[model samples]
Target: MKEISCALRFMFSAEFWAMGLCWTVSLLASYWQLVLRRITGRCEVYPRSELPRNLPTRPVCIVTGATSGLGAAAASALSKEGFSVVLVGLSSELLSEAMEEIRKRNKDAHLKGFVVDLSSFCSILEFKSSLEKWLTDSDMHSSIQLLINNAGILATSVRPTPEGYDQMMGTNYIGAFFLTKLLLPLLKTSPVGSRIVNVTSFTHRAVFDAQINEDIVTGKCFFRSKEYPYARVYQYSKLCLLLFTYELHRQLNLDNKPWQVSVLAADPGMVKTNIMQEVPFSLSNIAYLVFRVLGLLQSPENGINSILDAALAPSHVSGAYFFGGEGRTLRSSALSYNTRLGEKLWNISSNMFFDLKLASQATSSSS
Candidate 1:
């Protein structure tokens, strides 16, 4: 009994350990900025009044996974800021409820709900079609100035999406990729500078242990392999997301591209949300409790401030990484800044997108 108890107490917790390490690193990563902000009492988020005077009369913001948690909080806040917020989620009912909740906050909130299952390529394509049609009908298609890829999940067990990819990676990274690419054209057309904010995680730094060579990122090695633990897989997905952010930033900021589009990644710190509902109950509960006691767990509204900082950032900070309450722009993991790796990942991901589109078309023709 004593031995069993001792082992149980010492049972390895990958998530807890990863989160703890991430917490320490993120603090050190942004510690100076945090102190500077405290001393200067500086705020980074641009209030509506500070937005460029030539803003589209109806600037639009699309937030994925807007039905709950950090996504929902961000959608609500954006709507209240007078942007025509498009709420994207997997469930129609929940999306409606989220829009209603946001409306309750601001009766005049301009909100539209679109059902999008980020795990399914077909579903995301359908959302793009529907969104474009609505924007055209409303005459606001070119007004889409912000895209927040905030939908993510942490499954306790391995699961495959309809496309035979890991569900967590699909929903967190792949789906966001498809959605952003499909909408990039509209964003590029915005007269106002457009911004794309990817909701990354602090655990993204945990991927340092995993060699980030071409094979690992290109999915020839570990990705989609069920051999890894769920927590590790989640970290991998976030790392890919951070890579995508940097890669997209480089692509859009090229001299040839005649549009002002900035790409940023934000780490929301430790927000207690339903995204971790499927985690081992006992372990997650204890971890959250400890963090709560330490005042490390923030609410969704507070957690989303980093994301908001990215959305509201000026056009100059294109490749910034917003973190913590101060919304200080900080450096991401060293691996994230590997231009060669990010370029390779981007090329592979773009090719995969084309391949998936061809396959989807073939299936349609056969039917």
Candidate 2:
């Protein structure tokens, strides 16, 4: 009877409670640092006078998915900084609304809108042509200074694009890849040098499969069935973007060009955006709600802060992955640094684009 009483006392002892408290505190700290703080969005504001003055007097900054959210916020901010901003989106109405909001912030803002569905490679090609013509007509071909690949989508299911690739993969990574490649000429010609900021996500570390990556880029993979998780697909798309950023940076170095064109991946953390609108009543939704209530989700303005930093980064800042409101450079996933995987992915993507161009040409000739 005495032993039993002693055991019970030990179970409820101060030492036991102290140990438990320590564990709880440690867990909460880890969660806050790794998950919450990373996504909560923080920013350090630089006064207008401190803005990078090395750029052209009327530098050009192109922002994709600028109809709303981080892209819109970035466009408004850049315009206020005296950049001639080009807004890209899928809807003319949304583009006009975004432009109006930006102009309201900076009435002298030089903003132009282009409506192009990024989910479609053909549309990106059309946009590229139209953008080049506009640049030439405006005599601003040499003024291109920044490209923000901010457009992305989250799919609840695997829908195939018109080009027969997964919708999320096509829009988030492949389209951005092609668009940047197509605009390389203007970017390389920039007098103030250029920067390409690919808006990635921390989710890239969540789901990364090399085989799956190859399959998605080669158009041999589809998740239309319920077997694959749509959230994983989104993570994979971001992983592809990170890989592309690193690979592009490496290629730029290999080309040995004196003109600086830095490519960087920016993880915006967990911004309150429409990207997750497709997520149903899942654990993700629950977590999002908790984050919102806790005020851990970042605003669009705070979310794009890293992207702005990457865009204005110095020449030596190429190929780095930046995060949070601080815009501190951090090591990405192990796979992100795998040179072999990056090279393979780059080759596969280039081949896929080549095939797409050939197919388009064939269709046009047949027509």
Q: What is the TM-score of each candidate against the true structure?
A: 0.87, 0.82
lDDT of 1 by residue, 1-367 (tens): 6645533543575545665566556544555555676687663543323456676466889999899999999999888777889999888899889988988889999988988889888998888788888988887645578999999998766666777776787888889898899888888888878888999987777667545544444333445564446666777888889888988887787757533888889889888888767655565677779778867788999999888887886676777778875547656678888888788778877876788889988998999
TM-score of 2: 0.82
Off by over 4 Å in 2: 1-57, 212-214, 218-220, 281-285, 293-295, 364-367
> Residue 186's C-alpha lDDT in candidate 2?
83
lDDT of 1 at 166: 67
Candidate 2 residue-wise lDDT, 79-104, digit = tens: 88778899999899999999988877
lDDT of 1: 0.78
Best by lDDT: 1
The alpha-carbon lDDT assigned to residue 157 of candidate 1 equals 63
Model 1 bad stretches (over 4 Å):
1-49, 52-56, 209-227, 257-259, 365-367
Spell out the clash pairs found in candidate 2. Answer: 42-325
Q: lDDT per model, in order?
A: 0.78, 0.75
TM-score, model 1 to reference:
0.87
